[model samples]
Target: METELDIEEESDDAVLGSYEEPVRLVDDAAAEILILWATNQPVVWKQNFFVRQTSLSFSLDACGQIFTIIQSPSAMVKPGVTGAVLWDSGVVLAKFLEHAVDTKRLHLLGKKVVELGSGCGLVGCVAALLGASVILTDLPDRLKLLKKNVDANVGIPVTTRGYVKVLELTWGDELDPHFINPFPDFVVGSDVIYSEDAVVDLLQTLSQLSGSHTTIFLAGELRNEAVLEFFLEAALEEFQIGCIDQKRWHPEYRSCRVALFVLVKKSLSCM
Candidate 1:
């Protein structure tokens, strides 16, 4: 039986610390320019829904172009909600995807991909930009902001080979057939294993969404070692796991505070 755990709320400062990089917004007549410490390049925020003070922008350099993702910092304060802000793990994982493709270690072109707990949709957007059809999923409440970011980044230049769509996915709920009919070639997530209560359900959902041939990539902040260990222990029961070496991460976007892993369902014959 699954049990609920009482998770401590993260303080405002703790939440803001996720983005260790310095950030400043510059005002422009037509749009706001976000200057991120890592990528000194200014990301221009469109005036549509991105003009609010709560909106923040970050960039990912991938597929020979830059992808800008908009996040809502204000949304993070909602009770038990962490999906509104862009976390460092998301950045690390997204950049790792780019590095893997560039190094010919991974192939995503024309493949189907899914992102679990796709907060801010950074990793999924990067996957789409890398030519993979991607579905970005999270809780129903998270879809609003998730879709907003996807719409702003995924098809901007119309040069990507694959497309991206957003959907509501509550971990452990009975998944819609559309999500598993064609088992995704790759499942990616970042900062998803923060709470113990969600670990079991997350593993359950992962098991259902993956096939023997599917590969799962996850990254998380190292703030909670016990929860992460618990997740890994539980996940091993259904999948083969491996830690991705930091050496293989994107050259410029690496972090000691984030850990990345790759998992695959164990073949039934082997099991």
Candidate 2:
């Protein structure tokens, strides 16, 4: 007989698998997820949220990093859609949360960091709290939630630290030209590579905001060969790409592909 723990393990596999392939679950699948998450919400601060959670770099107030989260709104898709972006609160963001960003680990403190498609502003929030000047950004609708989170968290001093702010970042749309003299020192994007068409836009947008001193870290949850191949094609021109780490979450969801790169100049502004 299968125990409840076994059933939950199976459910985790099923949930992770739903990313790469469609799971023909009942019409109430979404509701079930909501209920499960709601039920598990309180347990986050208890003793069980440390096991697989959302894909955000949520800061845990206690000892050791939090290994779990419940950023459900960050993963909600645009109705009936499936694939990497579906429920992908940006796995790269989650990876950042799973892995800690130390101040001396390459001395990233006091630097300017910007995270694109920051579904729930996880990395940016952590970065800001960790002493870096971070801008948490995403699409307009997503930015609304991002703003709410920033407002709720910012200026509140993280035990002794500060908070991050939400910024509007539409792919292919560059920031104002006035701040070009002092561009961000670091740029981060996680679990953002999926669609084939958006590749060009994402790269082009990155190129504009980056400069010679800009160090960019990109994290992607590879869904297929095509997505990875297309991303490399689009991104190689403006940055020197190299893999840094790979950590598995589940069989269905590929381990997050973390790459570190230094931003160079582009020949022309595509944005």
Candidate 3:
């Protein structure tokens, strides 16, 4: 029988992803800062009860180099602005990719990857750094920030092995020819399943983009059991699903708050 957390276990780092030495921001409002490990880059924010942050940065260890991804944060008060802010699920997924590639467990070299809901573009950037030609997609409104980050981190000096591009992709809409002509080797998303109403649309897009050979990896925060369960039930009909236990994740990056999954076409898995 298929299970959500079905992957085999592997040893991983013990610490939650480490941070570098704290660096204070220029403004007096700067209170607490968390630095990414390896590169002592600081992520600073105001000292308020509800911190209002402008930008967030993370340093990841991958490709024998430290890669930094900078993100612009948007307030939730805005009607449709969740994509601009960084989320824990995205971080966990990005770090997992880094660790998996670094450890020689998941080979991304020369593969084509598509990241759904590429908010802040973290996972997509890391994939490029690991040698996967990647397309980062989201709504048209989210493209500007996604493109900016892709150009900054996945360009020449930082990622020469692979390439990254940004395109607008809505959940239920028709996919562009680029996504269908050469189906992606892997499709990925972090926190893409949040609402019950969007599940069918997301499944539609996933079905159209994947082939028998395509693999899908998704990470999400377990915010609502009903929504997640609904997605899982709907997805299982078309794909073979397996869950990656926290033990199999990057030691320091694994979290009970987030869940990671692996999916493959049912036809391929049944063979």
Most accurate candidate by lDDT? 1
TM-score of 1: 0.77
Write model 2 residue lDDT over 3-68, tens digit each, in one string: 111112343222111012112221232343343345434233332123233353344341243422
Higher lDDT: candidate 2 or 3? Answer: 3
User: How do these models rank on lDDT, best leading?
Assistant: 1, 3, 2
lDDT of 1 by residue, 1-271 (tens): 2111111245211101111111121112112111121232212322222113355876656767777777788776788888887777888888888888887777888888889999888888888888888989999888988888888877643345666778899999998987887888888999889788999889999889886457778887666446766776677666655556577789887765666777666553243
Candidate 1 weakest ten by summed lDDT: 12-21
lDDT of 2 at 89: 32
- What TM-score fits each model? 0.77, 0.60, 0.76
List the global CA lDDT of all models.
0.69, 0.48, 0.69
Please rank every candidate by TM-score, starting with the best.
1, 3, 2
Which pairs of residues have clashing backbones in candidate 1?
Answer: none
Model 2 ranges off by over 4 Å:
1-70, 73-103, 154-163, 178-181, 246-271
Instruction: Give the root-mean-square deviation of each candidate in angstroms.
Output: 13.9, 15.0, 11.4
Poorly placed runs, candidate 3 (over 4 Å) = 1-66, 156-161
Q: How many backbone clashes does candidate 1 have?
A: 0
